[model samples]
Target: MSLQPDQAIEVFYSYAHEDEKVRDKLEKHLTLLRREGVITEWHDRKIGAGKEWQNEIDTHLNSSQIILLLVSANFIASDYCWDVEVKRAMERHETKEARVIPIILDFVDWESAPFGRLQALPEGGRAVKKWGNRDAAFLSVAQGIRIVAKELAVSS
Candidate 1:
């Protein structure tokens, strides 16, 4: 489905709860993108009271132009993250309604990832080592976001 002319570009950040640090970094980056008029992001961290989290997540997953999966060992380990976000995103992808961009925050066996066959960002040598030089990794992630935003713009 095409986004309305005035509808904001919705993005869902999927990651394991254990990887809070990486999630925080992604949130900061997405915030910057929002400030720059790139896209708006949704995540459990931004959920407020009085809202059904599951329904909210499904709504965003259905409406979002892209779902950025923060792939890591911890992310794949979380059943909720996989079943709720990753699987939902995959369904959307099957319908060609939304795109899933897997961002590698930590080394995960790509061949063994829950969502097999999805291409991940910064693969192989470009993969980021834990707590090492994060700048390059963040830059790579930002680039991937830009690419998705550009695609969305063109498609819309």
Candidate 2:
């Protein structure tokens, strides 16, 4: 699974619509990696008009090397997030086809969730919203994702 220097690792953003703003902030923090060709991210918002959204989502979810689960109360409450996206993301992670990292955006009782066993971002699984300085929180998340991106580039 060696990535060519020019091939940025594909990142699939699986999150509830309520978390878009926070997701965008994280994306902004990831600007350096995107600019340096380390990763490319895809989410539902990128789906073109007239496209089948579900099919498009499934396509990226199945193909991407990294699946980012943006977690929060709203995210967990969404049936689609809990049932389809999380279910498939965990399946891929278990098979070694992709890396699934949970990004805790808001505090939630998620220790029993399917992705609970995997390491979460933002340093110590602190909710991004609970941070005193939001940029600092995003920075922690971006750095962690950067590490995962580099790992995916190495021997596998």
Candidate 3:
């Protein structure tokens, strides 16, 4: 997992619009890693106005070293999330081209989903929405991500 001084991992967030608030909180938790230059992350919300959104998403998704799938009922229901983002993410994951991490954001029937077998964040696969303290859940997820980001380091 060691990397050169110039190397850093790029992270991509694949989430549903319904979960934007949760995603924002999680992104905050990940700030330390970004500050330390361990990783740089992107999501649809980062797309600028007037830009071709799909092209921006595809470029980021294709290049990121770590892909976080923010799983929830809404995420599972989104056609774009399932049919496009998840499809390509999994393809990259299967080929060892990128690492896919399923982040449980809410309770849903997802054990049979494409990312079912991958170990999920906030240990025990407990959904963030179900946690007694939501911040604690995000902290757990961030810590897990830190570990993986370190292990998955790549050339910038």
Q: Estimated TM-score per prediction?
A: 0.85, 0.95, 0.93
Ranking by lDDT: 2, 3, 1
Name the regions of candidate 2 deviating beyond 4 angstroms: 1-6
| Cα lDDT of model 3 by residue, 72-151, tens digit | 99999999999999999999999988999999998899999988999998888999989999999988998998898887
The TM-score measured for candidate 1 stands at 0.85
Give the lDDT of residue 13 in candidate 3.
Answer: 95
Best by lDDT: 2
Q: In candidate 1, which residue ranges exceed 4 Å CA deviation?
A: 1-7, 123-125, 130-132
Worst 10 residues of 2 by lDDT: 1-10
Over 4 Å off in model 3, which ranges? 1-6, 154-156
lDDT per residue (tens digit) for residues 1-156 in model 1? 233435557788887888878778767766666776668778777778898988887777788988888777888888898777887898888888888878777766755655567776654424566536687677677777777786777777
What residue pairs are clashing in model 2?
none
lDDT value, residue 83 of candidate 3: 98
Top TM-score hit: 2
**Which model is ahead, 2 or 3, in terms of TM-score?**
2
Instruction: Provide the overall lDDT of each model, using Cα atoms, as 2-decimal numbers.
Output: 0.74, 0.91, 0.89
TM-score of 2: 0.95
